[model samples]
Target: MGVSALAEGGSGTSYPSHREPDGSIGIKLLEASSNRKNDPRAYLYIVDHINPGTRVSRRFEIRNTSSSSQRIKLYPGAAEIRHNTFVPAADRHANELGSWISIDRPELIAPPNSRIQLNAKISIPKSASEGERYGAIWAEVASPSVKPGSAGNIQMINRVGIRVYLDIGPGGDPPSDFRIEQLTPGRTEVGMPVVKATVNNTGERALDLGGQMWLSDGPGGLNAGPFRAQVGTTLAPGYSAPVMVMLDDRLPDGPWQVKLMLESGRVHHTVTGTLTFPEKPATWGLPALLDSFPLWALVIVGSLAAVAVAFFLVLAVRRLRRRRRVAQ
Candidate 1:
């Protein structure tokens, strides 16, 4: 990005044109030579183009024809170039200045009668919303550093604005919308369980609901269903549909987890419920006989009776031994 003065053979020095960090042509500043009584003028060559969502590095060359070293300051601002009337699509007004899509450093220094080049690199954000963005890069020559009485007052303030047009395409698919709730068991004898799930349309667009569920041993457990629910052709905004899930009574007696899965095209979501069965007491054929024997108390009585029988046997054996001794 090199800009030339193209002076019309004037008496005083003229400033060079402004160029974007990229090689594109920008604004031009025309400064009258002190000896010549011509007024300074500014000109710009606006460049417009589309930038794909990618990192861009640009280099700009500024040439100084003055006798003293000059200081330049570059800044980023809204695009002021008039080459084309470009407005971002309505969905793209959220981008802020100096975001990932902004210029690197915006300042530079140039020596006398020589050219200075500056490089700028910008990275587009990955999370940036999908839409078109419009902006520009602005460069202005700050107060020039000069010696006393150097070619009249440095009267040239060069400004160049470059228009940036960017288009960010659509991102990955929207997130899945599914939730599980209201899980309960049917009856203790049957050991049946029922679960309810609500699937809602949380995305901006309509989604098709189709998938299955099954009981699993773990959170990632078994396929509960391949149960189909005709949630209708479309789920309007903020609308939800109810799905009832039932477990077979024949399912073994133990802790069980029910899983309900919902799928829309390639997207899949799952919800789970856990259930436990309580132990039941044994029963006899006769209702009265069931409580007739206090089993725990009877066990204690039997243990005491066995202890008494052993004690009596020991006493009888001792008496027999004494009688046998007396007879001897």
Candidate 2:
């Protein structure tokens, strides 16, 4: 996580800044330079987990805090998991683990406070199956070529990545499967009240869904709330994702029995859904149709609608006195 070079009177070259473990200031390249004994070069990078025709080579470091002469570059991109976080992919490239990675050197110049080590290698193609694979490990710097009356249009490429977790095996970790495939209790075209659900990854890794919901069958020990979902939901495997959970119009229109729960490590899951709420619409709006009944059934249907409105106001005042005595 480092990149900052737009140069000139502003003096470029960045993408590497650290010193946090209580010290402070750590955002020069996204973070990860926790001063490993005074900046052991952004504390190195890659993390792998073998088994699958293995072949590794990790090595990374690139410093040149500038004094002129700094042209770094390197590649391997593709890594995303939106929402459930784990981003990394700016100047994207390749795809499947950046095509199995390979970056010995594509460009470098350093000089002036120098420090440059490369080597990225990662060959796993014995059919390469199993699970987990994301990529990233960039480090570019060059920015200061835009003076001609500058208002440019493009040219502002400052990079700083570092995130690669390639695991391929049935070995240690890579099994967080998934499932919660259906909950759908709707209303949201304006009538907002929701609770959708669907999350099937089915194992082999990639997930970031979260959960919580509660409300049950109570009668005198009332209790109904604790709804919290809409977490960073990522799910990528057999792919499937959608997990809404909205409801709150003073909830309570019967048939509730919620109680959902969910997790992703050591795997956990709980389910029990049913949240009905549809029948307050006759163009609804009498305090939402008396707040959807049940307070002794809206006081016995409002006392039988006030005795049928006093029997239709005694037949409309006896037919208005027989049409005013037959138009006297």
Residues 1-328, candidate 2, lDDT per residue (tens digit)? 2443210010011112322222111112222322222322223234346677777676656666655676767777777666545576564664667777888886777776656666677888777887667666666765666767768634556655565656688466555567675665656666655676766778776655556677677334345767767654657677787766665766655566677676643356767745565544322211111112224456888999999999999999999999999998
Tens digit of per-residue lDDT, candidate 1, span 77-104: 4321121123222332245434643444
Q: TM-score per candidate, in order?
A: 0.29, 0.29
Stretches of candidate 1 exceeding 4 Å from the true structure: 1-53, 80-97, 101-105, 144-157, 170-328
Clashing pairs in 1: 12-33, 13-33, 212-225, 212-226, 213-224, 213-225, 214-223, 214-224, 214-225, 216-222
Best by lDDT: 2
Q: Provide the overall lDDT of each model, using Cα atoms, as 2-decimal numbers.
A: 0.43, 0.58
TM-score of candidate 2 against the unseen true structure: 0.29
- Summed backbone clashes in each candidate are 10, 7
RMSD of 1: 30.2
